[model samples]
Target: MKIATYNVNGVNGRLPVLLRWLAEAQPDVVCLQELKAPDDKFPEQAIREAGYQAIWHGQKSWNGVAILSRIGAIHETMRGLPDDPTDQQSRYIEAAVNGILIAALYLPNGNPKPGPKFDYKLRWFDRLIDHAETLATSGLPAILAGDFNVVPTERDVYKPERWMDDALFAPEARAAYFRLLEQGWTDALRTCHPTETIYTFWDYFRNAYGRNAGLRLDHILLSPALAERLKEAQVDAQVRGWEKTSDHAPVWVRLRN
Candidate 1:
């Protein structure tokens, strides 16, 4: 089975690009982030016509997540992260599809750091860490896939010096990511292609994509059981060059069924 994750940026605005990619890639399971639309505004009909069934949690103009499955029924398990009653952002959704538990998430960007937004980002990371620990021991094949909004390490970014102070590359953020990995989740892409300069997101400004100036922000982490089945992992970097495409390209993993 092929599982993929992409930050569509805006589902409706980029439906064409998305649909075209779906036809070309044909992943069995897909996790999408940054819908940037209200629940009623999601293009359910269009997506359905593309040969997939989906469940999405959408908010107005920002922060949404969804899971699409073409291989089997998607049984939704959760819509939002637990232990955050006051937090209303539509950043998380979980479902069971094709015998694997999938969690799709859109971690906060937290730009212009050293402020409230950055604080929220760290707090959210803490919450995710707490939950990931439980998932690690659930004994089910699972994947945590989405735009993590993190650079993770120097090798994960194009220019480490230029991003040292950025929220995505901050020491605290990177440390949190490492701590999460300690919970027994494998970073599929990195595990598959360690030492390679792989990237999934490129900024639109300064001809970043043309220059290969990018960051590996989107990720698919596999639990031990799922990691054992990992056969291949790659980034569809060319997708970032498509007209009116998102800053993020699609990243996928092929698992032995």
Candidate 2:
């Protein structure tokens, strides 16, 4: 099976680009982030036409997440993070499709550090890690895929020094990301191409995409059972050149039978 993760930026705004990519790539499962639409506003018809069934969690104009599968319609698994009752962001959604559990997440983009937002980001990470521990004990094969919004290593971004002050590259963010991997979840892309410098996202500013300046914030992480099945991982860099496209491109990985 082939699974892909993409932060579409806005489902409505990038519908055309998404459709084209879907037709061309045809991943068996897709975890989409940042739909930027209300629950009622999701374009179900368009997604259905492409031969996939989806379950989405949406909020007005900010964060949203969804899972799409051609193998089977997603069976509700979980929704939202468990720790914070007051957390109102629609950033977490999980479903089961074809016996494989998938978690689609849009982690908080904690900008302007040394402030409330950054604090929230760290707190959110703690909750996610706790939830992940619970999932680990299930023994069912799973894949956690999404735009984590955190760069795990220096090699992940184009200019590490320039981004040291940024939320995505902050020490706390990197440590939290490392903690997730240390818990035995396999970073599929890195597992496939251990030494390669692969990237999944580019900033819209300063002609970043034009110069191959990007970050590998989007990822597909697998449980131990699923980890053994990872076949190949790839980033569709070409997609960034599409008309009115998102700053991020699709990141995908294939699995064995």
Candidate 3:
């Protein structure tokens, strides 16, 4: 089965392109981040017409997540990260598709370091770490996939020096990401192509896409059971060049069932 993740940027604006990719890639399960639409605006009929059923957690204009499954599967859309008493972002959703438990996430951007937003980013990562631990103990094959908004290494970005102060490449952000990986989860892209400069997201400004300047912010982290069956992993870079495309492309993995 193939499972993929994409940050469509905005559900309504990118609907056509997303549907095109869904038709072409044909992943059994697709997780999305940054839907940037309200719950009532998710276009459920459009997705269903494209042959996929979806469950989404949405908020207005900022963050949202969804899971699309080809075959009917057990799905759960949780409200917020555990242990956050006041957190109210629609950034996570989990579901069971063909016996695999999966979560789609959109970690906060938290730009302009040394500020409250950056602090929130770290706190959110901490929450994710705690959630990951529980998933680890669940003993079922599970995957955490989405636009993490993080760049784990210099190789994961276009220019190390250029991105130092950016939220995605900050040492603190990278360190937290590493901690998550240490909790027995495998970064599927690196597992399959560790040495390659595999990137899943490119900025829309400064001709970034045309120049091929990008980052591997989108990812699929799998539990041991799922990692053991991992057969292939890749980014569908061509999708970035599609008409009215999102700045981010789809990253996916194929695994033996």
Candidate 4:
């Protein structure tokens, strides 16, 4: 099974690029982030025509998440993060497809740190870590995939020093990311190519893509049951060069069924 994750930036605006990638890559399951559309606005018909069924939690103009599966019906498990019913960002969604449980998440970016947004990002990470502990021990075939919004390590970004002041590479955020790893969820891509410089996102500024300046923000994490099945992990970086494409490229993992 080919399981993939991508942050489309805006589902409607980039529908063409998305459809093109879907036809070319044909992943069995896909976790999409940043729909930037309300539930009613989701282009379900177009997605259906592409041979996938989807369940999405969408907000009007900002954060949104969705899961797409061509392998089987999506038995939705969760729509948003637990522990805060009042917090209403469409950032997390989970479902069961093809016998495996998948959690699709769009973690807070927490930009311009030393402020409220950064605080929220930390709190959110704590919640994710708590819930992830349960899933870690459940022993279910599970995958946590999407844009985590963390640079993770010095090796993940093009220039570590230049990003030290940025929230994505902040020590606190990176520490929280490591805490998730401590729960036994294997970082599939890093595990597959430990020393390789793999990047999934490139900003629109300064000709970043052309200069090969990028960050590995999107990730696919596998639980113990499915970790052993991981065969290969890759980024369709060329997709980022497509006309009107997202800053993020599709990242996928091939698993033995």
Candidate 5:
């Protein structure tokens, strides 16, 4: 089965690009982030017509997440990350599709470091880590796929030194990512292409995509059961060049059924 994750930036604005990609890539399951729409505003009909069933948690003009399944009904397991009752952002969603448990997340961007946003980001990571430990030991085929808003290592960014002070590349954030891996979830793309400087996102400014100046932000992490079945992984980098596309490209993994 092929599963993929994409941060569309705005689902309505980029509906055309998304539909076009769906027709071309045809992943069995897809996790989408940054819907930037209200619950009633989601283009459910259009997505349904594209041969997939979807469950989405949407908020007005910002953070949202969804899961789409082409093969079977997507049994929703959770709508938001646990342990944050005051937190209302629609950032995490989980479901079961085709016998695999999938968690789709849009982690906090935490830009302009040394501030409240950055603190929130770290706190969020801690919450995610706490829950992930449970998932890792659930003994079910599972995958955590989405835009993590993090650069796990020096190789994950185009210029490590230049980004050292940035929230996404901060030592604390990278350490949190390493802690997740310690829970036994394998970084699918990195594990498949260990030494390659693979990237999934590029800034629209400064001709970043053309210059191949990018960051590996989107990820697909596999639990032990699913990791054992991991057959292939890749970033559809060319998708970033599409007209009116999001800064992020699609990242996917294939597992042996």
Candidate 6:
């Protein structure tokens, strides 16, 4: 089975690019973030036509997430993180598909730091860390894949010095991410290619992609059971160069049955 994750930026606006990639990649399961559309606005029919059944959590012009599967029925488990009743951002969705427990998330992009947004980002990370601990030890074949909004290490980003003040690169956020990994979840890409400079996102400005300046924000984490089955992990870098494409390119892993 092939599983993938992508931050689409906007589902409807980039539907064409998405469908084309779906056709090309043909992943059995996909986790998408940043729908930037309300639930009613998600292009369900289009995705259905593309041979996928999906469950999505969407918001108006902002954070959203979804899971698409072509292998079997998607048994949706939850729509948002537990323990946050007041929080209403559509950033998470989880489901069981083809014997795998999977989650899709769009972690907050806290910018202009040392403020409410940054604080919220850390708070959210705390919640995710707690919840992920449960999943990590669940003994189920599971995956946590999405745009984490975290530059986990200096190697994960292009210029560590320039992004020091940024929320995504903040020590606290990176620590939280590392803590999550320590819970027995394997970072599939990094595990597969530890020393390689792999990136999943590029800035729209400064000709970032052309200059090979990017960040490995999107990720696919596997539980111990699935980690042992990881056969290949890669980024479809060329997709980012497509016309009107998302800033994030799809990252995927091939798993042995």
Can you write out model 5's per-residue Cα lDDT over 183-224, one digit (the tens) per residue? 999999999999998999999999999999999999999998
The alpha-carbon lDDT assigned to residue 181 of candidate 1 equals 94
* lDDT values for all models: 0.95, 0.92, 0.91, 0.95, 0.94, 0.94
- Please identify which of the two predictions, 2 or 4, would achieve the higher lDDT against the true structure: 4
lDDT of 1 by residue, 6-50 (tens): 999999999999999999999999999999999999999999999
TM-score of every prediction relative to native = 0.99, 0.98, 0.98, 0.99, 0.99, 0.99
What ranges in model 5 sit over 4 Å off? none
* Each model's total of backbone clashes: 0, 0, 0, 0, 0, 0
- How do the residues 66-156 of candidate 4 rate in per-residue lDDT, one tens digit apiece? 9999989999998888999889889999999989999999999998798999999999999999988888899999999999999988889
- Candidate 3 lDDT, tens digit per residue, 1-257? 99999999998999999999999999999999999999999999999999999999999998999999997764684656888778888998898888899899999998988899999999999999999988877788999999999999999999889998899999999999999888889999999997998889888899888888998899899997678999999999999989889989999999997
Residue 8 in candidate 3 has what lDDT?
A: 94
What does each candidate score in C-alpha RMSD?
Answer: 0.6, 0.8, 1.0, 0.6, 0.6, 0.7
Runs in model 1 deviating more than 4 A are none
Candidate 4 — which pairs collide? none
Residue 184 error for model 5, in Å? Answer: 0.3
Candidate with the larger lDDT of 1 and 5 = 1
C-alpha-based local distance difference test score of model 2: 0.92
Q: After superposition, how far is residue 203 of candidate 1 from its true place, in Å?
A: 0.5
